[model samples]
Target: MLKTAGDRPYRGRLAPTPTGRLHLGHAATFLRAQERCQAADGTLIFRNEDLDPQRCRPEYAQDALDDLRWLGLRWSEGPDCGGPCGPYNQSERQPYYLEAWAKLRDAGVIYPCTRSRRELRERVAAPHEEDEEAEPLYPPEWRPAPGTGQDAQEPGEVNWRFRVPDGERISFEDELAGKQSFTAGQNFGDFLIWRRDGVPAYELSVVVDDLAMAITEVVRGADLIKSTARQLLIYRVLGAELTPRFAHCPLIRDEQGKRLAKRSDALSLRTLRERGLSPRQVQDMAR
Candidate 1:
């Protein structure tokens, strides 16, 4: 877990996506976060990142809570506790995201684009047969004019993107991985802040929620390490406090060294419970 800068009590979070049942991968991260909080006499908040309304289910959210409890993990606050930093669920925190988007707009850091999924995919698939290096190409119009207010355009007409500062390195120290860095304009070009459908994108929403909740540490899977740089830009744009230190735990992988998937039944806590595996056994397996 990321340590606080000083003597301040650490505040960490376990934000689970309720797209499916909690799996072994989920348990491992949750356990780490819980342990970190307990070690610091700190608070661990449970957040439901259930923004994808089409797939997220109330039952799955409840199951997630049950599974965590069954695994002997507890949180200091959640949707049930009415904590100071609530609407613990991302779906319920729309206004917070809207506020963040507005701040980016006011700072001239974001713009609107009109690229479709097919267009983006084709661009990334372009031929590069030569060994000579070439930068990833984004459509010219992808960087929308600042203050265009075109993000208010009709669906499919525009999407919001952050204007990455060219040639700058976005770097941060990870408690587990040590110093890590990425070039802002090289590793990623302008990225979406809002989808064509007007929903705040994950990049923006997660940063906004973390700041609003005053999260002191972000204990998550290593798969999201790349996201830290993007989020740092958001924190910079918003003039929010520096991000909490990050601890990206190793991912849980299958025997083939592939990351666990939603379809991996053997990793599902619910399935393991049905087969009479005790929570202690699951924890041991995760360790």
Candidate 2:
């Protein structure tokens, strides 16, 4: 992942999931990404994170692209226009995930997990949130015996999790959120890189794609700070030569002061457009 002189240029991207319509949360993040790229004299890329075939639909993807264009956002490369590092969709990049999995397997930092949702729910306690909350961290005790060498796992089906050291402290500076730190065992435990369903987890795919796509800065909702910490661990284990900078935007909340969800049709871009709101009006409402 090393870049020679004149090889690195500021690059960023918007990764939208096709699970639902593009909501205000997405707009706030994408707008920030576009502004940052402009300020840095960089290029922007668009990527589709449609890893879940059951939920991801082509119509949703098209609507997302239309919404982005309706907002006057443009990208140098994306699924709509092919780039050198396409296909931009995560579902189409299984080869890269396989390669990374093999690397982690050879390095002995990965192990198979059999813990189910019920098991994790019974073990990991969810902290109460005044507004909204991120995904609960996993408990390391749920893991199988510690991985000691390469090829420890059978090729049979199982969730692949990366082994994180106990009490290891990780620190990183975010371009927007500033200094952030978290302890491995306390903030989160060993996490999944691949699931039994045969798709790479979000943590693995994001890191792999950012490095491979040469994304310079990751612009996302502040809700993913914990995920950032998780991905950081993977970057360390893989010895990534180019880890992108991060910029987490503030989340949009509802009347209850809770973060918005996909079901909140009132805040969706499609609804706003149907209400005769112009791009500038929607931008103003987003702010």
- In terms of TM-score, the best-performing candidate is 2
The superposed Cα distance between candidate 1 and the true structure at residue 31, in angstroms, equals: 0.6
lDDT at residue 199 of model 1 (Cα atoms) = 74
Model 1: colliding residue pairs: none
Task: Assess candidate 2 and give its lDDT.
Answer: 0.83
lDDT of 2 by residue, 23-76 (tens): 888898999999989998999999999998888999999999999999889998
Whole-model lDDT values for every prediction: 0.80, 0.83
The estimated TM-scores of all candidates read: 0.90, 0.92
> Which segments of model 1 are wrong by more than 4 Å?
1-6, 126-141, 150-157
